[model samples]
Target: MDISKLKEMPYDELRVLYKQHLHSLNISKATINTASVDTFYLWRKDSKTLFWDTVLSNDFESEARSRLLKTLSEHSSGNVNALVSGYLSHLRKFRLYISSDSTWEQSETNQVKTEKNTNLRRTKKDIVIPSPTVEQVEFYLTKWDGLENYHLQEDALNKLFLELCPNNTDILDILLKASTLNDFYSTNIFSIYPVAKHIRSLNIDTRLDAGDVTLVRDIQHVTISNKKRSFYSFATKYCSHHNPLDYPIYDSYVDEVLRYFRNRDNFSDFQNDELKDYVRFKDILIDFRGFYGLGTYNLKQIDQYVWQLGKDYFPKNYGKKKRGDK
Candidate 1:
């Protein structure tokens, strides 16, 4: 639990560490690496790490941690899987005492292969849904000539959801549920409410537009600290788009990754797919996803593992710094 080491090491070093520490494949019919062990030793020499650390230092409350983890289980499967595999990679890399033949990377590959494997399916409940062709997406999206804004929103939402959700049933359920919200913004278009105004301005390119968001100073004053009502009012603007779900609500993990990259590139905010670095972020994420089997596995799980892996291994650069900029 040396927070400093976890927060200071660059990913390249961490990647090597990953290959050393947990190198062996913990083949369990029920779980990959049961109990989620902290196998690697982070070099924590002092207590000055909190300047950037959050969960690792117990500063984040139980509620925050729970919400973060739940976000992984629900909205971000991709992050969870990234954490798991990356952790396994870290273990295999550092703990050379374990063995040299531990190609943990292959183990990760093999795990996906095992899941796809008909032989494994006969014994497991895991479901691998094929990504829908764009034709199917176009059909579903255009089937109903909804409002122009609704159509635009739905298209964006569909692409985001379908890309993230691999389980067919899960994907369909999410889309169906989201379709109802298409009209949520239509009625609010002329409303002067800050939330409404923000929502009206949010399109794909305007996603990062801070104008759509308002940080209200709702927290009056709680000098009592940690035990206050801690009330701060923030409005959820729907924007010109149909729904917020289209862009995965950058959860704490996502926030961390995004911030790292943003700060490294010195970007104060991102408003749309055109945020000078969108392409770069897309490429980095795509490469990472391809390295693993994101196209095949549950998108949420993949997200989880990736974010966790980044945090666990690339502590210094994981969520604090990124290089690419468009």
Candidate 2:
């Protein structure tokens, strides 16, 4: 298979050649589209030597032949019944490769193009949740202050812990009742004592850090039940009641909103699991604030806004809908 001969062959002949090679490799599921065939012809005409150089540079002859056969597969439209489209796309990229003679794997222009395409793909199905504006954050905060029941419940918990359990001596009692109100059902009834004991041992009366949060959350295995459970959200909530500014609550609503904004606005780069880590989570929250020019608002306020935003838009409940609900 002298590919140099392909350099002079007409476009129709190149298409036939690609089809023949693809068939010879037992790869005939896809109908090679005309556009890909045209690109292959142009690539061969303009840079067959460069293309061959890339293919034959492989150490093993079998590797080189495999590369060549891969390059010969045509791009497909509609359903991809074979692995041909990827190889054809690579051949398409070869035109850009030789045109720039870039030192890097991709030229700057190609890099931009690739990124643009990538972002488009990432957000194709994503409902673009609007990034928070100063007005929007303020609006949500105002909404938060208006929720009377929320304030009532939060105020009662604050008073109880600050005054009654100031040294957390009665933390076990506070937790037993508070768990129900705060919806810490995931933390077992019997585990409350152990979790309370762990918190008291930390003596986070004045300050709390990432390590403290991790310790409090990981009191699962030490519990009476001895089951593997994590109270990550519960830990954040408890620490937050003690020091709201230091510890941001990790509610599902807050988590969903952070992920949505992170995806939509590129405010921060973090793995989904990293949000479970207190320090990284707080840093990401700070980055979100800075990115959206909401620096005037504190983490607590930002938490309120994002949590409400997510509740309104990304509700997890799939329960039966009301008559007029969307």
What TM-score against the true fold does each predicted structure earn? 0.24, 0.53
Candidate 1, residue 39: how far the Cα is off, in Å: 6.9
Residues 133-186, model 2: lDDT tens digits: 675687778987898867676687677655555454456755654464344223
Candidate 1 residue-wise lDDT, 161-193, digit = tens: 344432223424334323323233222112223
Give each prediction's root-mean-square deviation over alpha carbons: 20.2, 17.7
Model 1: CA > 4 A from native: 1-192, 201-246, 255-279, 298-301, 304-326
Please give the lDDT score at residue 11 for candidate 1: 43
